[model samples]
Target: MARALNDGPGRECPPALPFVLAVGVTGHRKDALPADSLLTLHDRLATVLKALTEQAAAVQEANQSFFSDAPPRLLFVSPLADGADQIAAEIALRLGFELHAVLPFDRGRYRADMSDEDGRVRFDALLSRATCVLELSGESDHHLESYVMAGRATVAHCDLLIAVWDGLPPRGRGGTGEVVRLAHDRATPTIHVPVAASDELKIRWSAFDPAVVTHAEDQANVRTFGEEELGAVLTAVLSPPPDEREREFIHMFQGECRRKLRTRIEYPLLLAATGVARLRRHHWRPEIGAVRTHEEWQTYCDACHKVAAVTTPIASLQSWYEWADTLASDYAQSYRSGHVFNFVLAAFAVLLALTTLVLPDAKKILAVAEFAAILAILLNTQIGVRRQWHRRWLDYRQLAERLRPMRSLKLLGLAAPDPPGTAANPTFGRWVDWYAAVVWRGMGCPSGAIDGDRLKAMASTIAEHELAPQVAYNKSVANQAERLDHRLEIVGLTLFTTALLGCVVLLLGFAFAPHWVKANSNWFTLLSAGLPAIGTAIFGIRVQGDYVGSAVRSEQTARVLEQIADRLTRNSSNLSRAGDLVEEAARAMHADLDEWRLLNQQHDLSVG
Candidate 1:
């Protein structure tokens, strides 16, 4: 009859895919690359970009089902400086790739670096065509730090870097060589195009060196990669790594749920304290539209903010899972503790009654104590019902489980619409809709088709990472529920057997030896009443726990998930079929939630 302290299942969210591949550009000024060579670099860069577009199209074709409403795009980002950046941007634009400019400073001052009138005109035209321009604010254009900031921003967002250089050290800060070194240190992949050696006199000054250091001969030399090598590098950079795996949702659930639950429990206590303080002050009218003191206004604002915090959708999947899990676990613990105390009190009361009947003296005192015990039991039950701890526990648990599958589905790029064809607006306050919307927005439609090799890798990931763990967890839950169910029935029946035996003994003593019966009549009476009373309390505890019903429901859910796991693990299952199986599992999970909700509603308990 002790309250169950079993831990419930935790939830997890699926990891998201990278939405775009950003390519960054860094190289020398226009003077370093002759006009003829600059045109050659432009044509070669354009050809490479066109081939990349085709590769994206091929990926899109293979993984048609994985995409969201808006397909992912290939983004080419640059500082749009006078030489290499401008050439790359012009080529990328022609190939239908997005061009994002990360400027060192505002255009007016940055334009001063162009020097030539023709270069300034081209810079303005390219800036107009850019999809996005990120200007470094609060920095003077006159400073070299501004240019460095732009270079750092470009590297930060891009997956690959293209450098056009003459293998020379930087003449000043924010030069091509310095940017290339940064890219190398960060392990960003780069394709360097060599420039022709210049015969002009060079002014070399190194702050680190004692005297001005000059190169005996220019290091600039040609060693260009073939078309095949460039294509292979581009493919490697753009494609998602086959081995990269997303983190599981349950791990996050376990961590986050505790914090969320604590906040929930504190809210009511805080609100109650606030209410009583105002009540103590006679005729304190804290009307919404009325003028108030600073303290009153602050309290009002704080209350509103707390309400918003609870009701709003938690943006991160990990955060959302934690809150729901914490709410469920805390409420469940409270519900269990109340039932345990009530069960113990009820049984003790019955024992006290039997003692009062058989005792030679202080019978009235013993009876009063027994009555007090019963009153305590009833009071505890009333308090539990008024607080609605059991109901809230069930509701929060339902929400948590429903969200778990969504994390996996979204991560695998196989999530289906709830009740297919229904548009789920995630902003909806209802947890289900809100969670669905958040996941959908988080994992937007990917336009690139996944090749067969990538598709196979995804299938293996689903089987090992998601389906395998879920299968094990559900099976364990089912087994635990069944064991609890069996124990409850056994205990309930044993109590009834004890009561029946006590009745048999009482009847036999009264029927066969009349003289002996009179001498021990009090004992017989005690046995007849107290044993049955204890048995009745045992039955009541069993009814409250609903162990049998829970066991059956858990077993059904476990079986459903197990079947889905089988489908997912089959060697012949293609990516499309795996997607279908995942979708089926999601449906099954939701169905389980609906069933639990109905059961909790039907068995709603009240003090009356």
Candidate 2:
């Protein structure tokens, strides 16, 4: 069928391929300068150049790897507005790329508007340094002129606009509409950079629950322009013969499960079918996509997801494969650590439980350590489970996107290993790793180690990820976990305090507590007090279930992060094209409390 269509007349695919001919970055407050207050302009200027060089190299690498071997030429365009522009220009200059500084027509007046003495000096330096300056409109307002000039450069000169917009759409300034309007007006492509200004890590993983992305997939008219191309793809995927390796492996697993065509990619093939069964068995696909109008694609995605859920088993096999291969040392370390921690907790718990039965000493410290260790195991388990789920979705999402012709899923990992002296996950890693290294190992660190009182103020709102519906919807498992965690924290704190107080009360009763009354006047008084204490103990014990705990859902977070990162990865090929869907979803999720009501203005006006 596909062969027939490929040979069809008037419907031939183009061989020219997609390309980004130029790069233009523009933003107010020199958005590319990394949001620092301590740095001088000179210090920042140096950093920005380095940043552009590295980023451009990354861009070039992606282009070379994916689209073509011929390295794309860099066309640096900015107003040269003192910081990012100056750096971009200088970097381009040093890299021997063409620098087209699209300046405002009234560059003199724009220069005049600078009230800051340092800024004026820096601007003067930037202007002098630029390769060439093209003019914007002749306007009185420098702010207005710079923006207009930027708009013009995007339309008149640049092929692609790299908007270093700090991931925010300000009032009439950095909005997508501004870019779209200009792009439409001039018919140029634009790419917004830095993903989002507020995103510290510059990437995040989203739970690619097959169901969620399925709905998105259904809605996508990847065949915006028809079925001939899509049908060709569908036939290729659905009718392809299974690989020989898959066939041999399938017979090994179960002779009858083998099909003539299925033997080729046996591992992934059976794994997908088996994985689907497992995910369903666990009821992990929490949210279902709406029943679709397109039944064929829907069934296809479902089958694909089921087949891919085997990704967990596949990843486990891969993990084992790595262990068997060169990563043997790393795997050995992981296994050893796992066993050591398990042994330590099991021993500690046994000792603590024994002491609880017989000891009259402050042997309770043993229990604290045991409980903390248990919590760590549980948290790590949750994180693992979440990651497993993400791996499943990621494998399929890649296949889905590739098949859909949405965009290619290229990445940094395939080409290069991490450099020395950097943590794997940097932004959240510092805090997460610090806790793992210091606090999470055992309970009760030094007095200096904890700021218990400081945590009290923020206790009610512990970075409410649940309130963000996208996170909640996409990562229901993780959201429940985060909620359970927060609840457990309260429970853990209460129980620890209660246990301490109980020991103290027992101690005081044995000695000084007799002061209030000739306390042993009646056994009834002691019984009455003991009854309430027992009740409190029971309540605390019940609350501890919250700490017995929810899974970490880290995989869900990682999957979601991959989706976010994938957006950036796609842009390296088509530098001017904007993927606003991700930006909107992210902003909608990340928006704090204040933006909601202001953002929902029409509702109240309509209701009132």
TM-score of each: 0.47, 0.26
Cα misplacement distance, residue 286 of candidate 2 (Å):
70
Cα lDDT computed for each candidate against the true fold:
0.54, 0.34
* TM-score: model 1 vs. ground truth: 0.47
For model 1, the stretches where C-alpha displacement exceeds 4 angstroms are 1-315, 363-368, 417-449, 571-573
Alpha-carbon lDDT of model 2 = 0.34
lDDT of 2 by residue, 1-608 (tens): 22233234654321111122345555445433554532443343334434544554554344331222334445565666655455455555666555655554446766765646666786777667655554433345445534653554443334334444444434575343364345423323233334333332111111112123222112221222122332232222111123444323212211111011211121122223323212221121111211121232344334333322111111221221221221122222232233333333444454454554344365577567668866766664454344332222222222222121111100000011111112221111111111111111111100110012222211111112111322443455455445544543454456456656755665677686665435443333333343344444333322322212223333344356445444533443221122232332233332321132133222210100
Name the 10 consecutive residues with the lowest summed lDDT in model 2.
407-416
- Clash numbers, per candidate: 12, 28
| Count of backbone collisions in candidate 1 | 12
lDDT of 1 by residue, 248-359 (tens): 1222222332322222222222123324212221122212112222233244334423322111112354444445655566666567556655665677787787787678
User: Candidate 2 at 528: error in angstroms?
Assistant: 99
TM-score of 2: 0.26
